[model samples]
Target: MKTFIIRSFIGIFFGGFLAVLITNLTIIFGGLEIIDGPLFVKNSIGSILCGWFFTVSPLYFEKRNLKLSQQTILHFLTVTSLYLILALTIGWIPFTIINILLTLVISIFVYTIFWVAFYLYFKNQARKLNDCLKRL
Candidate 1:
């Protein structure tokens, strides 16, 4: 349980950092100017929340014997839906479409890397715990 909390925090911190980095890079190189508005804050918070939620989702579901593929799909759908609703609430339909597309592109890469790291860390811990239990 302690390991799970530590790994989740690490994943959220790194994942949030990566998402910010990517957003800045897009503004720097892609010629996209950062919009300063309530929507921006909404999007930023939504991304971080999504990162934390997805990071922990797989671990929680795995204990119930859910397959990785199923967990991944479930996380994707759940996060995407949450993001869409948040975006729509902030900026209506057109802005929500834009937000969803951009968020999807950035989040797919960021979360995939974070998820893999978290999974490997927890898997190793689970193995170690199983070994310790067997020894007792």
Candidate 2:
């Protein structure tokens, strides 16, 4: 519980940071004006919650006895659904079919990149551990 709380805090901070960073970047590159204070705050809070869930949702994999593929599918679906709902509600993405489809495609791409990176990293770690055990 303590660890989870700590992780959640980290996620919140990360989310907030990303929200600000992305907003600033968009304003800079896209020539968009800064939004109103209340709207900005709401969007920031939404991003923070999104980040919190994205961080903690993986804890489900720890407790479940499902296969790796099954766990991945479930996690992806759950996280993606949460993201879409939160994004639409917070006005991060407009509630249009085209916008939703585009957001979904981008989300899948980002998730795939992360999944591949983590998979390779863990596989390498496992190999190194196996080698150490063989020497013992």
Candidate 3:
């Protein structure tokens, strides 16, 4: 739990940094003016909240004895749904049908890659451990 909180803080810090950078670019290119300073503050808070939400949501559904695939799917769905809802609510993304489909596909692809990488890594470690035990 301590590690989770620490990592969440780190993620929020980085997310806030990225939010500022992106906001500046949009302001320049999109000619979007921030009429109030509170907009910037709100963006920062939103980024942090979104990051923390994604980081922590899967933990609530995690089961120790579950299959890796199940865990990965659960995490992926939780993060993707939260991200989509938040993006739509904050007007970060338009809620067009094509845009929604494209965004969901991209998110699933990215999350599957992340989870599969970890799955393969842990599977290899377990295999090695089992082989070692057989030699004992």
Give the TM-score comparing model 1 with the true structure, all chains together.
0.48
TM-score of every candidate relative to the true structure: 0.48, 0.82, 0.70
Off by over 4 Å in 2: 20-35
Local accuracy of candidate 3 as per-residue lDDT tens digits, 1-136: 8868876887788778778888888889988876457777777777987878776766744578877667777777778888888888777779899889999989878877877787799899999999999999
**Against the true structure, candidate 3 has what lDDT?**
0.79
* Segments in model 1 whose C-alpha atoms lie over 4 Å from true places: 1-65, 92-98, 133-136
RMSD of 1: 7.0
Give lDDT: candidate 3, residue 101. Answer: 94
Best by lDDT: 2
**Which candidate, 2 or 3, would have the higher TM-score against the true structure?**
2
Residue pairs clashing, model 2: none
Residue by residue across 9-33, what tens digits does model 1's lDDT show? 9667866786688678778999986
Indicate the residue-level lDDT of 5 in model 2: 94
- Across 80-102, the per-residue lDDT of candidate 2 in tens digits comes to 99989998988888999999999
What overall lDDT, based on C-alpha atoms, would model 1 receive against the true structure? 0.71
